[model samples]
Target chain A: MLKDFVKNIGYDDPLEIYLSKLEKLLGSEYGISKRAVSLLLLQEDEEIFELVKKNEGDKIGVISAIIREANSHYSNPLSYIISERRQGEASRITNSVMSVKEKGLFNFKETLSRLMMNPFIGGPILLAVMYYGLYKFVGNFGAGVLVDFIEKRIFDAHINPFMVDLVNRYLPYELLRDLLAGQYGIITLGARYAFAIILPIVATFFFAFAIIEDTGYLPRLAMLIDQLFKKIGLSGRAVIPLVLGLGCSTMATMVTRTLPTKRERIIATLLLSLAIPCSAQMGVILALLQNKPLGLLIWLGVIIGVFLFVGYLASKIMPGELPSFYMEIPPLRLPQLSNILRKTGSRLKWYLFEVLPLFIFASVLIWLGQITGVFGFLVKALEHPVRWIGLPAQSSVAFLFGFFRRDYGAAGLYDLKTAGLLSGNQLVVACVTLTLFLPCVAQLLMNIKERGIGVGIIMSTFILFFSFSVGYFVNLVLILSGINL
Target chain B: MRKIAIVGSPNVGKSVIFNNLTGTYADVSNYPGTTVEVYRGKCKIGGEEFEVIDTPGMYSLLPISEEEKVGRSILLAESPCVILHVVDAKNLARMLMMTLQLLEAGMPVILVLNIFDEAEGLGIDIDLDKLAKELNIPAVKTVGTTGAGMDILRGKIEEHVKRFC
Candidate 1:
């Protein structure tokens, strides 16, 4: 057997003494070796510390004394010293067992990786990536082109009509028929939204994301954004969840589990809910504002400003240690085509499974509200704030739809735009408020699940109020200043 | 079933190796830190059926993030027959710390020096026999994405499991 083959890594004398002391004191069988647990305790790993405290009821005082003694002996933090020793051992082993030939030509991949992190070069590259990857491709091609083909040529011409006719013919009772196939019915609106408007946009975004992920540029981009993130009290490590928020805030909210501190997780979740629009919302917003340069610029400015401003305020108000960033940068490589396709396929599979059920549920809920006359009442109530933001009374319908899902609301606005109802300034204001509005039902549930009901409810309430106030303020400033786009 | 759990730092091809051994996909990508959850599948290697778990990436035994906790829980609970500590061969030094930790924990660990193609391209030649003897554990070189040396890795796992478990 290999039982006696365990490598014995000797730590410095003082730490080693504590490790032995802790190992002797440990009576309850931890699943791992007591040696590993003892090392973890020396590193001040909080969970292990608590576990040891729980397991060793009376021996804690001696363990604390030993830890303090070890701490006093080290000039640096114990973790730093321990990690350095481990690294030294690792490199020593590597040197003994590996040989290298001088293949020291310039690694173009390495150089390109640096160029991506360099501020002057990275800034333009980021813009080009955003403009092409997000705006032009997802906006023009997915939302504009593919959505028209699916929504108009396919759904409008065939599926919706067939469903409506089938409902009319089969169901004698009007209410039952309307619930499944009427104006806001599950078949008519929910399925259409999922397949026609949202699918094309989401698939395109995932395709772009897969390629970006394959190239290993995210961590380098993280390095570039680290400074700005520092100002917002987040380390560059928050970049992963925050950037993933662009794809889907619901998933990103869950991804915030990777954040180190509770403060960072809450702050990241708040920012994701308030500032980051999910892919469908992003695609629709791009399709709406891409042609209108001034309006699109204003929209961009508003969202970024809100993201930074709110993050800063939240960090200042909530007390925690400022975040520290440390992440390994994977080297850049040309993305493998097969890997890209497989990753995209898997992610797309996940996105559809998560979002589709929610879309259908939203439609059924809307139908219930409409038949019960609550939808009319809610939209009527929302119209006051809608008009206050310089939007027409009809815009309240879109705003109400936003409470269910952001992209659905944005799609409603897209319909309004095609009807030539909203002016440019009004369009900007509507976009700003909708982008900042409450998280979709799925995200709200995720927030509740992760952060608990009290925090989730409080967060959504604060977001609802702040988004409108900003919309009102932006509209007022633009109107009073006579800025025309 | 006797289990073989694959673990390493993020983006080091744990999922790829898992796929090669299990014939199932676990969402491989070039970016670091994408595997946020655990994935499991079944594999038949060396005439033995083993349950294989692909865990979320972890840096060290002292877990700082939730994903690391998820990865560590399986190690402490399931007590896998062989811990395949997959490391990117190019960054072998940086990754060896976790392998060292796993070994010190008295777990049965087989070092998977993965991405050998990239290491070879960088002119780094690893003497697998020497490395294995130095570390006092079995080591295999693999390019997980392409299944290079996967059979050797599997054979090593079955050998370790049969010997220890």
Candidate 2:
């Protein structure tokens, strides 16, 4: 009844003829009109190409010829030509139907938004925001005071002792009691790490991220970083996933699918798995380095250096066109408090559900390994790398925990640092190596899912060895220079 | 039952419009590229039930990313009774490329100039009647966040469904 009531694109005669020809050859029906499918094919849409090749076997040569003819007539790519023509028509319609009132009171949001995109201004503003939002809020308060209170006051003084005593009194079996509430018990290590150490860190991070995200500042950050990013073989578009990686790398790995090219996805996945530290690890690292300013600076320097060096090298090795970025920057707004709270709430729920089980599971695996002597061997294997990096052999446990989760390893470091086992040089080296370590197992699996098994395994292996080498090099440099930190 | 699918470029208020129309929360955020999944909800207009699918923001018919591919596939598969070609009102020229594509596909699309208030605040005024007449389809302006112009939109949806479905 409504056959072509609203006219489609006003295609020129040649294109219209080609569409009809392609329509007839399409043979089987796609859910959409063959006209649309033909347009997609002209644009060289890969999935549509596969669909057409499968559905319209012998007729493919003729369709390709038609597309080739169309391409010859246009200097621009067909996709560009098509969109440009559509835009021209849309402008014509919009010009006739819309008017500007010209009341143009300059909005403050507009000025602020422009300021945020200017590199000179935006860089300083970004630093300030990070210092206050992440350093002060998440690191100092969340990981420092909050974690100290929860891990020491709440758990150490009360919960762990209570649980241990309760288990000892109730369970006569020594192994069962140890499994339940021993030194590395599920109750003591796993739940404590989840609730006491990592929780406050990520809670504060998500809160800060929600507010930053809600204010629509990330795109501006992208614009500011575009110049720097290009040098690393990524365009500004890579900023979104990389910034989000600061929140959680597993989620960020999944988010990499939003990148325009498979090459971009691979580069992004590789970079994220290596240099980007998730929120929990970031906060904990920051808190650890807070007292040692020199150590913190060294760690920061090493990470940025590795990020640039490796990215530049990878871009050179990988064969792909340089990424061209076009992004929409939403108008900055005062973040709604209600919305921020809801975002934080939802993210916290997601984080807890994801990590809490792994925390407990890692605990069980460790306990089982200890009973079977596998844990000792694994730690022994890790001790060589730890010692090579100038860290104590006991720090090997932290490296072992790194396989489970980044933050779990950091929490282990927190324990070692509190026990005064690592020096200033050792602390800086440890933070650098761990920050560059392969992301958690979930992220590893996500990498395989997104980038396939070969790339995934290869990337992870590279990350593992590269991280230790960087640590060893840093340690060597510091020792040779006789640096205090 | 009839169906309406909301489609457009990212950061336009498609998800907000979908939420306001269907009263379903689908994570409306200021950032684009956040929604990597599709959302669907059942809505009722004019005493008849309808299914509304909220697609990921697609830039054009041509797919650049997985999200756009998913968005295009949803539109192709659902064959919704009405497609709301939601656009950022301020950038109507860039957004309407997809609208033209939908029209070319012979889909019943209603041009929704969303973020209407912000566009007006920027001194941009759109003539709904003239746009509707020019396009030969319903055109409505909506500030999806504030629920402004929702009633007229609902009316247009019902009219479109009654005529087509």
Best by TM-score: 1
CAPRI class of candidate 1: medium
Error of 2 at A113 (Å): 2.3
lDDT of 2 by residue, A1-485 (tens): 33655477666676667667777778887767777888888887888888888988898888888878877777878787677778889889889988987775767888999889887899899999999999999999999999999999999999999999999899999988878898788999999999999999999999999889888999899999999988878889889999999999998988787888888889999999999999999998997787888898889889989988988989889978888989989988777787678778878888899998998899889989999999999999989889999999999999899999999999999899989888899999999999998789899999999999999999999999999999999999999999986
Q: Write the per-residue lDDT of candidate 1 for residues A417-440, one digit (tens) a residue.
A: 989998889889999999999989
Q: Judged by lDDT against the true structure, how good is candidate 2?
A: 0.87
Query: Which regions of candidate 1 fall more than 4 Å away from where they truly are?
Result: A12-14
- Per-residue lDDT of B158 in model 1: 76
Q: Which regions in candidate 2 have their CA more than 4 angstroms from the true location?
A: A1-6, A24-27, A44-46, A73-77, B1-4, B18-25, B40-52, B150-155
Q: What is the DockQ of candidate 1?
A: 0.71
Worst 10 residues of 1 chain A by lDDT: A1-10
